[model samples]
Target chain A: MSVSLDPVNIADKLSLIDELWTQRKIAGLNDYEIKLAKLKGEFVWHTHPETDELFVVVSGRLTIRLREGDVVLGPGELYVVPRGVEHCPVAEEETAVMLVEPVGTLNTGDTGGPMTRAAEPL
Target chain B: MSVSLDPVNIADKLSLIDELWTQRKIAGLNDYEIKLAKLKGEFVWHTHPETDELFVVVSGRLTIRLREGDVVLGPGELYVVPRGVEHCPVAEEETAVMLVEPVGTLNTGDTGGPMTRAAEPL
Candidate 1:
């Protein structure tokens, strides 16, 4: 069966996520986790050993940092962070994003730190 | 690193998908494919025994038909068709959709037909 949601009209959902840090699970599979998150400020550093993570910019600007370089992603741009790569995602302003990761994956991965934003949806 | 795409401001991307029949794979994992598609008219009757397919309308409306009942999904609506369920998606007017399904999936599944839409991107 088919149903759809216009990504352009998800204000309410975004507002909901603003007060929370969880990546709301929209739909996903064993290979990836598709989630929507509201983010701002500097996020923790982490890596995933099981799967590559992708971020698609929908609104606002998102900055991704690696040891070598940093990418500034705007709306309509996408970035792929291969598995086992260390990186950090930060936003100077409020930004909304869609995250795709594998199931049973950890947001923090092997770097178990206090800043690891690892938790299920609230 | 982090990137995000706001679901509410995806008009340009939707327009790009117009006049197209393929599910434009945006991002994915080993188990699923996330795609954006522009659709009108009746799609094939098919089933996926390996995964539950989800349809989210980003704009316009969508309809899903099952052997028993059909569901009419609006812009904010979502529907998940369980695996092994025979179903068809039909649209009478221009519609945009976001699809979540497993990778290497057959849109028509076991009973392939001319109506089955299978192809890589153009």
Candidate 2:
């Protein structure tokens, strides 16, 4: 497959996304995928047994709740939820986030449920 | 090694970097690493034969010159340079960027020289 050489404007992509908690793949580096998601309220508590998940808040605030404590993030802040660690992402208002994870990694992770959805290209 | 659950503020880390073109590791996701770099002027033309390199502009603008064409990126923009493609990053003014690539991927890629430096933690 041919890789496009165009730059992806994060804000533009995020504006096109209307669904909350749905990840849209923007780019790929090696086997990992860079995804953008609009998040609100709360996400399911889950763990990825095989890989770490990186969350970068693009707009608004995000609180990553772990068993130990909550890692609150604002715009331009990032947090990594380590492998096998349960994390639930919560946001009071609408938040734009960029996520980096391995290809095929689930959004709901090991605790797949109604919120689980496969990522599609934006 | 224990992973810290603290949120890494991208602007805060960028403020700590003094030298241009130097990369500092901020977080790790599986075998890949997330890095922050301050860049200005031109970088050496290089290619990562083994992996693709991702660049996200946090502040200012960046131009990734590939053999095919130039990809201009402004703040909140990103582009992925495919593996084996020669690329040279240039910024007219000081730019803060976030990079995602495999662990041990060099700043200079296959063309290591005076511009090459090992990434240290931020």
Candidate 3:
């Protein structure tokens, strides 16, 4: 599908989420995938040992808790979680975020838990 | 630098552009790079033989002209120009965009001209 004609409205997509946190794949560029994720509360601490993950805040606030320090992001701000770094994401309220990573990446990375779920393609 | 604390603001970065079209690299993701660009007119036609280009519109509008047709994008919209596909970008008005591509991919792709320039890291 052509993304230009139907640009994914992040708010519209996030509003349909039934779970506390959910990820929806919006577009795929060869080996890379762009996803929209709605997050609330806290996620399981995890690390992607093979690939970096790019997170762009679309709305609300998000924080990546690391052992060294915490990274907080606001709308229009982006952060890249380096590979092999342990991090946990937390959202005080409903938040919308954009994620860029490899096509087959898992949400929980090297760790898995109840938060682990396959991404739904938009 | 950590991306979380210094999250790149798409609007703030684009507002400082002095050229008709300029790209600024905000962060690197292993082999990929995230860039912000401000466009106000037509750019040279080009094609990347080895990598697809992902373009996400942050504000205003942008059109990617291809031999098959034209792909137009607006705020929050995204499009991926497949590798080796001849294309040209044109912005009727001032527009802010985010680009995701390989680390060393050139703006003009296989073709080179006055439009070719090095990307400034943010």
Candidate 4:
């Protein structure tokens, strides 16, 4: 490496996996975290009232659905869901991505449904 | 999309580019932000005194250099550079990544050397 660093390189952490629904915690502050989430197929619909989430698709394709419509995020693209907004995430095929938000975040926002929470902290 | 969404999908935002040195703001709290930074080549040497930055390598390869040694962050790998730590980041080839830090973060931290600040807010 020739360039001098600031103190961290979070992008390096996201390369750990290439599968769907994989959550890898790369870095965080007291209230927020940077995570790598891989996705395939479809996920349950949910929302968060306390904080907004930032999703960046590093590879493959990604889409987010709101109550009214859906937004598609591709490589080098991003979307912000304001707090308390209900939305769903689904990938037609295998997709790799990164997530930044607070810690202890519930997958389904405040409403816990059948597929709301994630079991592991990869 | 089948999974319930919190307020954001940062990975979806990252998919907006594939070039090097492209900085895109995905989301942020009052003081922090989730960014998708496209990087290549070697960056300047610098450090920050008040904040620690997280870099997650989503594609290609990434490496962080400190005065003592260098830590390489491959895809899916993560490293935390404590505040006031001096380091450098370099990629032998083009790499895609996600960065999480504060809103007014300096690329070279407080030291401010050549290549310390970014000109754009992508």
The most accurate candidate by DockQ is: 2
Candidate 2 off by > 4 Å: A1-3, B1-3
State the C-alpha lDDT per candidate. Answer: 0.66, 0.93, 0.84, 0.68
lDDT of 4 by residue, A1-122 (tens): 34333334434444566555657665565456667777888887887877877777767888898886778877656676767778788899778776777787866677677655552444
How many angstroms is the interface RMSD of candidate 1? Answer: 7.1
Report the Cα RMSD per candidate: 4.9, 1.3, 2.4, 6.3
Worst 10 residues of 2 chain B by lDDT: B1-10
Across residues A1-122, which tens digit of lDDT does each residue of candidate 1 receive?
44332222344556666443357766544344457787788877877776777676667888888766787887766676767678888888888876767665665677767644543542
Q: After superposition, how far is residue B103 of candidate 2 from its true place, in Å?
A: 0.8
lDDT for residue A114 in candidate 1, whole number 0-100: 60
TM-scores of the models, in the order given: 0.75, 0.97, 0.92, 0.68
Give the TM-score comparing model 1 with the true structure, all chains together. 0.75
Cα error, candidate 4, residue A26 (Å): 4.7
lDDT of 4 by residue, B81-122 (tens): 767778788999877777777787877676676555552444
lDDT of 1 by residue, B33-101 (tens): 667788788887887877777776766788888887777877755566777778888888878877767
Instruction: Write down the C-alpha DockQ for each prediction.
Output: 0.16, 0.83, 0.56, 0.19
